[model samples]
Target: SFRFFQLDPDWISCLIDGAFSVGRVTAADAAADQKLHQKHVAGKQPPVVSGFLLRSYAVKGWPKLQVDGYKQTAQDEADMDGYKLKILRLAHLSPNVLLCLFEGDAVAVDIHQKPEMLHLGFEIPDTKTPDNYSKNLRKADGTDKDNYKNPWAIESIQPDPATRVVKVSQLFLDIEKKAALNFTAPFTSAQFALSMVEGVQKVRFVRSGS
Candidate 1:
């Protein structure tokens, strides 16, 4: 079966830069399903549609970590330090396409404007388990301080005979403009990263099946 995972833009940037090494999972990870399960069992609350739970959704032999020679531009490196981004992982489902969801901010009394956002995608090494998976995670190397607390990789496998390799085909920024208003302003990834660092809200990842 196919599934979707939501990620922070900072983590996504790290994925693009090849320096990220942690992914966080929490009770909120399965909040939607848990609420639904509760509703079905007791009919007490409304059904909430959220991402799949990490505990149940993760594939076996997953949460793998590997080093890929991914690098970011000098501008990106200079701007990344200000944002408080979280690392997260989703396993089990091998996504064939990736989508980014950017929520517009309320600008005026009747106007909503798109915030600065950047879209990027890249291929990493195939998922594999390291010989010192647990040991490497435990060692604090001053670079990845939260390594012990987060899972660094996702494992993807073909669920059927037809599917061969899972890859991302699309990467672009999504912005909403008021139909009645004609506003055209182009923003770059660096600006988006700065906005995120400045506490701009409503940016997330949306994955789909191929």
Candidate 2:
């Protein structure tokens, strides 16, 4: 629901190139779990931007929708559930892109006849100590619910004219395949955009009845 207009292209370039440095958790977030806070302070791990997830929901009174040329197929299947895509605020940056700490399967479904919605789920390893401390420090809805074990779900809004929505799974796979071939070369934005387009084109829409 919040927007960051005209983000610096160089910064965006840095993000796509994975050139940014990791940051520490916020004081407010660290306050939620003391053990997690201690871990954060002890430099066990630093917060890093991971991946982004996108999904759509239906609301009453909104006009019929089309996303990336996919028309609204089921009017009665809008996502009315309380679950919302979690939005995170970067240190000094405005709310821009959704970030995840890990990678996992992306789930897509048509619910209540709304647009086909996508859910990006990150797979954080289960161990005595978790690598994704930020994920373990927040609730499912991206709120500070004092519960740290909730899974991450990111919903996408309509893409801005310049923004592109890509299938997370496909992009991940493409990146992996490319990395295997060019292990030493740095991944470029152009390559990422190419992967994104490939992924978006592969999404199949199915109409689920209300």
Per-model TM values vs. the true structure: 0.15, 0.15
**Which pairs clash in model 2?**
55-156, 74-113, 76-112, 77-111, 77-112, 77-113, 78-112
lDDT of 2 by residue, 81-196 (tens): 22222223212122332222222111222212233433333334347633321212212122322223322211122222354443555444444453322334455554433322
Candidate 1 clashing pairs?
23-87, 23-88, 24-87, 24-88
- Give per-model CA RMSD: 25.5, 26.5
Global lDDT for candidate 2? Answer: 0.30
> Over the full model, what C-alpha lDDT does candidate 1 score relative to the true structure?
0.27
- Predicted candidate 1 versus true structure: per-residue lDDT over 78-173, tens digit per residue: 443343222222233432222212121111111111244222222233357221112111111113124235433111222223553322121113
Model 2 bad stretches (over 4 Å): 1-64, 67-177, 180-187, 197-210
Please list the C-alpha lDDT of all candidates, in the order they appear: 0.27, 0.30
- For candidate 2, report its TM-score: 0.15
